[model samples]
Target: MFFSCKPAEMANLMEDEVFMAFTTYAAIVILKMMLMAPLTAYYRITRGSYANEEDVSRKSAEEKKKLLKAHPDVERARRCHQNDLENVIPFMLIGLLYALTGPELSAALLHFRLFAGCRIFHTISYITVLPQPSRGLSWILGMLVTFSMAYRVLSTVLLL
Candidate 1:
């Protein structure tokens, strides 16, 4: 008699909670990259300090201020993207840990979507030169999302 053989089951990362967070991370990263496109165009058209330069990261704060003074739109884009870099990273990291802890899909989606959505709106508001409270609200909302996830993870660890 011949023995029957079965193939091992392949786990789909898409179904993993951490992968959900990772996909969200990718979206945020890509969103930030797309935000830079217009910034680059503005820089090139306005001839900002680092536009033609090979090394864009060596500029001192003074040089940056000069560019800002010369091109207000570029400054807006710069600040918008810089703020994203500061905020998005922590959100992604904490979110990954939070998801791995087996947070509900709805909860994870809430955290991921709200933060990314707020970030998009935040950048849009900045680039359009919107008033303070609206832009401020977006930043606050994103912070709250990240903080909530952090609390969830921390609370879980503390209980353990």
Candidate 2:
């Protein structure tokens, strides 16, 4: 007995890997969006404001001071959330590069998942009660993913 492979089948298999990577990226993005909800709620509840810039500016200095003084945890969460958003573009670029460069799709997918998980954990630790080490560890893990991806892309570009 012998086995035979078709050209169309091989092509389809190759396409699956890229599709899988894209789907994984999309899933992580959705999770990131979901994670923002709790952060937003905490901000709204403690800061008494939403994403409206005008509304935030309308608050008196006394009120702003009172909000910060009243809920330090919320302030911390807001700051952390903003930092996370700042890094999101780089993270997405890393994933996209990996997909484009035909790296180990599984590794890229795992990195994306790890980053998303670490971010959620970091947010929870920030918004709720948690030890410093635990929160710090989560933050570090998230940063590691971002940096690792950036390094991968840079190395690829430089080596060419």
Candidate 3:
């Protein structure tokens, strides 16, 4: 019996891509999961109904904001969480789509890294009250990643 190694092609799977896909998923999941910390802090600080009738009855977000007014840290945490949801959802979906096509290993790493690192740094900056442009730069990094992935997926390089 004999076996032969095949060249890199559509049928071939690169370890970098495969590992990045798995790690990207893990990192995304962790980022999402970590939001709970701020949420818990908000709930504790605000002392609002996190799981009780206040949640169901307070359909008006304005009401919730009013409740959290006394706790600026909590309010900031909530806003940061909202921002994360706004940006991360699209990025996560786009990242997953790109992962399936298995882009160039280096490109994949850069995109994944920028996307994850930007989000992480953005959250840190938001929580730490960093000056202007710090958060914006991180956001742009993540957006650039998504844009790059979108372009690659749409480009002639990979029809998938």
lDDT values for all models = 0.72, 0.67, 0.66
Summarize candidate 1's per-residue lDDT along 1-160 as a digit string, tens digits: 0112234311444567655665866576567757676775766456664433434446676765554434667667777777878888888778767765667777888788888888888887988888889899999999999999999988877654
Q: Order candidates by lDDT, high to low.
A: 1, 2, 3
Pick out the ten consecutive residues of candidate 2 with the lowest summed lDDT: 1-10
Model 2 CA deviation exceeding 4 Å by range? 1-19, 30-38, 41-43, 46-70
**Cα RMSD (Å) between model 2 and the true structure?**
7.3
- Please provide, for model 2 over 1-160, each residue's C-alpha lDDT reduced to its tens digit, 9 standing for 90 to 100: 0123378765664576754765676566556655776966766775665444454576887766544343565567667668667656667766666555555767777777787788777777876768899888987887898788777767766555
Overlapping backbone residue pairs in candidate 2 total 0
**How many clashing residue pairs are found in candidate 3?**
0
TM-score-better candidate, 2 vs 3: 3
Positional deviation of residue 56's Cα in model 2 after best superposition, in angstroms: 9.3
Better of 1 and 3 by lDDT: 1
For residues 1-160, what per-residue lDDT tens digits would candidate 3 score against the true structure?
A: 0123366543443454554564665477466647757665665545653434454464577766655434555656667777777777777766666766656777777777777778888877887889989998998887888888777656624435
The pairs that clash in candidate 2 are none
Distance from true location, Cα of 104 in model 3, Å: 1.3
lDDT of 2 at 1: 6
Q: How many collisions per candidate?
A: 0, 0, 0
